[model samples]
Target: MSLEHSGGENADSDLYRIRHSLAHVMAQAVLDMRPGSTLGFGPPIADGFYYDFVLSEALNEDDFPEIERRMRRILKQGQRFYREELGADEALARIDEMGEPYKREYAQELLSREDLDGLSFYRNGSFLDMCEGPHVDTTRDIPRDAFKLRSVAGAYWRGDSDNVMMTRIYAWAFDTREALDAHVTAFELAQERDHKKLGRELDIFHLDELVGRGLPLWLPNGAVLREELEKLAKELEFRAGYERVATPHLARADLYRKSGHLPYYADDMFPMMELREAGDDGEAVKEAYVLRPMNCPHHHSIFAARPRSYRELPLRLAEYGHVYRFEESGAVSGLLRVRGMCMNDAHIYCTEEQIRSEFKGVMQMYAEAYAAFGLSDYRVRLSRWDPEDGKRREKYVDNPEAWEYCEGIVAEVLDDMEVDYVDGPGEAAFYGPKIDILCRTVTGREEQLGTVQLDFAQPGRLGLVYVGADGAEHTPYCIHRAPLSTHERMAAFLIEHFGGAFPTWLAPVQVRVITVSDQFDEYGHAVVDRLRRRFVRAEIAARSDTVSKKIREGTTRKIPNLLIIGEREQADGTVTLRRYGIRRQQTLPLDEFEAWIAEQIASRALP
Candidate 1:
C-alpha cells in the first residue's frame, strides 16, 4: 500500500513486476498498431494495467488482437530494456522527432516541476518509451501464460474534459493460468448476476432513453420489492419509537437557501422548475421549485414545525422520501446512481447528552437490520474534521473544542463496540462528520451500500432549538442514517450477492409445485393454495409440459422449493420436495412439508 510503503522494492512481487512490464509492452503494441499514436503514462493498477494513448484514429474492437500480437512479438524477441537519462530539451526533441506529441507535452509539463529529475527513457525491441522505470531488465521476464487484452475505453487526458480524450487499453495478467481461469469464470458469473441484465430478465425495472438516462421505471416486480422493504422499515421504525411523516418531492427555492444547499450542492440538483400565476393583467411571476436532493432538509422542517421542550429532545421523525439529483450523463449508471430514487431516511433530534445513546441505538438497529439479510463483514469510514488544518475554527462551528470533543466521543463509541473502522480526514459533510459503511461485491468491486451521517450544522442554520432543563435554548444533534439504503440499490446488491438464488423469504417466487401429469394439476393447485395461505410465495406450473421440462424451468427461475406430486403421492397424501441448488430430494407428508418450508422461510435459510 502507498500508505505503508513510500517506495517499493522491484523484486518484492513477481506479479507486479510482470504486470508493470506488460504496460510497457502494451504501449509499444499501440505505437506499432497506430503509427501516429502518442503515449501517455501506463502504470500497473490493482488488477492489471491500462495505458492511455492519443491516437490519430479511433481504434475499435477489431484492433485489440493485432495490438496483442505485436506485444507477443516483442516478448518473443527478448529485447533488453535499456534506460538512460536525458535533459529536458533533449527529451522533448527526441519525442517530438518521433511525432509523439503526448510524450512531448508530458515532458514539458514535468520540466516545469521543480522537484522532477531530468527524464528517463526505456527501449525494448524497436520501441522506446519515456517513463520512470523499476521494470524487469528484459522482455523475457514478461510472463506469457495468462495475460489478456481486456478492453478499450475512453479517458480524458489527465481526467480533464477540456483536454484531449485519449483511448485507454486495459489488460490483465495473473501469476498462473488456473488463477486467471478462476477470475474469468467469476467475471462470467458476475455478468449473469449483473442487476441490469437480471433486472430485465426477471422483469424488475427498465431505463428508457426517451424518459431520460438515469430515471428508472420500476416494473411490478420491482414495485413489489419496494413496498416489501417499506413495510419492513415502517414496522421496524414503529417499534423503535419513530413517527412517520410525509414530505414533498419539490420544495420552495427558499427552503434550500436556508438549508445551505443552493450554492454548494447546486451541481447535484436538478434544473429548477419555474411557476407563475396567470391573469388578464398578464403579470409575470417567477418563483423556483427544486426537486429535493436529500430528505434531511425536509425533516428539519418537521423538527422546527412545533415548539418543543427538553422531554421531547430525542425526537425521531422518519420518512420514505423520494429525491431527485441530476447526475452527469457520463456518470449515470444503474440503480447505484439514479436521477429519481427514494430513501429509508430518518433524522433524530437529541440533546448533547442524548447523542451517545442515540448513536448507539442506531448502531444496534443497523446490526439487527443487516442480520436479517445476512450481510456482514463491512468496513466503516468515519469522517472527521481535520484538526491539522488551523482553519478548522472558520470551517466548523465556533465551538472548536466541541468538535474535538465529539470526535473523541464517536471514537470511544466505535472502540466500545469493537467495530473495524478507519478515520478519514476532511471527508465529512460540510455540516459535520459522518460514517459510510463500505463493502466489496462478489466480483471484487467496492460499494458504498449504506451510510450514517452525523450533523451539527443544519439545525443551527435553520434556527431550530428546544427549551432545555435550564430554561435556555439549545440545538439538538442530528444523526441521519439508512440501513436498507434504497429499494433499487439494495435489490441490486442482494441480487448479485446471492447470485439470484435468493433465500425463501425474499424470493419473488419461492416455490413451484409441479406434478407428474395433467391429471394431477388439480392437486398441484391445491398444494400452491395451501402454501400461499401460510404467506409463502408459491406458484403452480400447469402448462402441458413434461415434468423434467417443468423442473428445468423452475430451477432456471431460481425457485427455492419444488414440490412434485404424482398419482401415488396424491393418493398417499404425500409430496416429493426438490430444493433448488441442492443434490437430493426428500419425501414428506403434506403437513410435515409445510412446517419445514415455513421454518426455512422464517429463518431466511441459505440453500
Candidate 2:
C-alpha cells in the first residue's frame, strides 16, 4: 500500500511515524490559525514534512514561533486521534458542510470513481479531517521540542501551473531532537560549500540575468576545469577505441519526430524554429528546426550517414557536445539544472554479438573515471521495463519480446562482471533499459553521476544498418554511455565534493607565491616564472601586504599549494611550502617542489 493509505501504522520505522504524525499535527495548527484554510497533500519527505494549503492570508516563516506555541498547547491537552469509516457520498457531504471546498471536490472525484471502497476520517478534539489513520494514541506522544517549521513556498495545486496557486509550508521532524539539530548543521555546511557561491569567489563561473537564466558563462578558471575534465574523458575514450565526433546544436524537427522524441519530449525541448523555402514545384515549403535536446538521434544519423560492414561493427562515436532544454524556472538550481549543458556523451553501434563486450568496456570506463575522481561509494541501478505498469508500458516501445531480450542481455553482462547492482522496474528509458550510477554527494544529495543505456529501438527506427558476414542487412544495437556526466553537473559536484579545495591536478590555481617583503619581490617573481614555465598554474603576490595576509588570501581562495619566498628561502634556493587545509608547512628545494607538482599533474593524483 502507498504511504498515503498506510497511515503511519505500518511505517518502516519510528522516524517515519514521527514525521507523518507531525504533518497531521502541523496541519491542525495551521487550521486553527486560519479557520477556513483549505489543506492539500501533507506528506513526509526525506528529511522533513510539508503541508500545502490555500489560506486567505499569506503565511511567513517568522510566524512559526506562535504556531509552535499553539501546537505545544494541543500537545499539552493530550488529544487522542480517533478514526471512523464513512461512505464516499457521506464523506463528500461532511466535507462540504465543513467549508473545505478543495477537500469536498476531492471527495466528489473519488465518489465518481467506482474502484474505491470506503473513506476514513480521523478526529482529534474538535478538529476532524478526512485521513487514513494509524496516528498516535494521543497528541502527547509528539515531541514538541523536536520539530520546527522551516520555510514557505508557492506551489500550484496538483503541480500544474493552470491550477490554483497555494502555499506549501515545509517543516522538519525527527525521532530525536539531536537528529534534527544534526541535519541543520549539515545543511549549513552544504550552504557554505554551495557551488553558486564558490563559483564566484573562485572566479569559476557566473550566471547573469542579462545573459538569461540557466545559462552560465564559464570564466577562465571554470574553462580550465572544463578543459581538464574533457581532456581526461578524451584520453579515456580514445583508449577505449572511441572516435571523437562533433554535432550541431540544432537539427531539423523531422529528425526528432522520426525518433519519437517529439511526442514524449516536446515540452522539455526548446521551441522549434520554422523556415520557409522554395520546393521543386516553385512553391514555398516550411521546415522546422529545433535546438537539440539530446545527442543520440544525431549520432544515429551519423551511423546511417553511410553504409557500414560488420568489420567496423563497433563504431563508437564520442563528443562533448552542447544541448539545450527548457527547464522550468522554479526547477532550475545553479549548474545542476540548466538549459544549456555539455554532455560527455558517446554512442556505440555494434552487432548483437558485440553488445555484451561493448557494455563491459563502458562499465570499465565508468569505473576508471570514478576511481580517478576518488568516488568509491556508488551503486549501479539496472533500470528495467515493467510490462505490468500501464504508464511505463505505453511510454516504452511496444515490443515486449525485445524488452525481455535486452534486459536479459544486460543482466547477464552485469553478472559476468560480478558487480553488485539493484533492479529498479519502470525506470527504463522509453526506448530501452539502462543502468544508472547513483551516489550521494558530500552534501547528502543523491546524484546520477553516469548512465549506460541499451537501445534496440532507436537504431532501427532511424534506419541505421550494417551488412552482416552472411551478406544480410541487420540493425545494430546501440549502447549510449556517459561516464563523466556533463561538464556543468560534474563541476558542481566536484566543487562541493572537494569543498572547493581541489587537488593540485584539478585545482584552477595550483600555486600562489607570497613574498615576505619587498626585498623578496624578485625571488617571488622568479619562483612564479619557474612554475609557470613548467606549465603549472602559479601566481605571485608581491603586493604591499603582510605575509600572513597574503597567505590567508591564498588559503581562502583554496589554492592547493602556497610558496613563501623570503630572504632565507631565496638565499638557500629553497621554497617554504604551505598546503591548503593543512596546519604544517615544510621547506623543499626549488627543483624538488617542481618535480613533485609535475608528477601530480601527470598522474592526476588526488590530494
Worst 10 residues of 1 by lDDT: 1-10
Q: Candidate 2 residues 210-245, lDDT tens each? A: 998899999999999999999999999999999999
The lDDT per prediction is: 0.80, 0.86
Clashing pairs in 2: none
Misplaced by over 4 Å in model 2 are: 1-14, 83-121, 130-133, 154-166, 277-288, 377-379, 386-394, 440-447
In model 1, which runs have C-alpha deviations exceeding 4 angstroms? 1-11, 85-121, 160-164, 278-283, 384-409, 423-426, 441-444
What 10-residue stretch in candidate 2 is worst by lDDT? Answer: 1-10
TM-score of 1: 0.89
